[model samples]
Target: MRPKLLAAVLCLTLFGCASKQVVPTHNESRVQAEASLKAAESAGASRVPEAAQHMEFARQQIADAERLLVEGEQEAADMRFRQAEADADLALALARSIPLEREAQRATQQAEAARRSLQ
Candidate 1:
């Protein structure tokens, strides 16, 4: 039991001390982020000031990720790419809500009219 415990501890320690090794496959993430940003833009995110911040943040994050990638920081680049993607997604979602808001307003007006007719 003592030998087994020692072996397990040694294995854990060795694994813990090992340097993190991640493949530099950030190209896919970069592409995904860029596509998302473009989608948000094409979806009229810029037209809605509410999503402007998200679109800007996403752009900045993509730039930073590119810089980090050039600096050979794969992990940081990947994180930034993911962040950019999320921001872009938020911007797109906000842009999409515009039509939904209009629909809801129209529905409310119809409901008000129906109630007035009943009265």
Candidate 2:
């Protein structure tokens, strides 16, 4: 009984010390950030001031992430990549909103004109 117990404890200790692979998030986040940036550009964020600012921020964050990756700071690199993706997404939204805003203003004017005619 004593021998079996000792063997069990030794096996448990060895298994606990076994190294496991650490999957890095840097690559995944980097891919997401790039995609977001492309979407923002396609939405014409470069032509919209507000969106352009966010898009620029996204680019900078991505650059930072890459630098961090080179430095072997996987966790920090992952964070920067997430930040970049967020900024790019915001830029895309803002770019899309510009055209929608114009349409809204046009509708408002048409409504006012119809109201005046009715009066």
Candidate 3:
């Protein structure tokens, strides 16, 4: 019974160590970030000040992540990739919101004008 328990403990310890060796790569996050950046650009993020800033940040983060990956810093690279993805997504959302905001402003103006006329 003691030998069986020892063997089980050894196996668990080895398995845990092996699992730690499996470094996670963020390739999918990188891909998603690139896609989001492209979509933001397509949505005219470059024309929006805040959105452009976020887009630039995303690009920088991606570059940094790539460098980290080459340096074998898988955890740091993964974090940067995720940050890049978030920035790109935020940029896209901001770009999309600009047009909607303009539309809302126009509608508000129209409503005000109609109210004035009725009064």
TM-score of every candidate: 0.70, 0.74, 0.74
lDDT of each: 0.92, 0.93, 0.91
lDDT against true structure, model 2? 0.93
Q: Determine which window of 10 residues in candidate 3 has minimal summed lDDT.
A: 21-30
Candidate 2, residues 1-119, lDDT tens digits: the string is 99999999999988887855656577888999999999999989999999999999999999998999899999999999999999999999999998799899999999999999999
Sort by lDDT, best first: 2, 1, 3
lDDT, residue 74, candidate 3:
84
Q: Write the per-residue lDDT of candidate 3 for residues 4-80, one digit (tens) a residue.
A: 99999999999999888654458877787889889989999999998999999999999999999999988888999
Backbone clash tally (model 3): 0
- Sliding window of 10 residues with minimal summed lDDT for model 2: 17-26
10 residues in a row with least lDDT, candidate 1: 16-25
| lDDT accuracy of residue 103 in candidate 3 | 97
Candidate 3 local Cα displacement, residue 34, angstroms? 1.1
Which scores better on TM-score, 1 or 3?
3
TM-score ranking of the models: 2, 3, 1
Task: Please report the TM-score between candidate 2 and the true structure.
Answer: 0.74
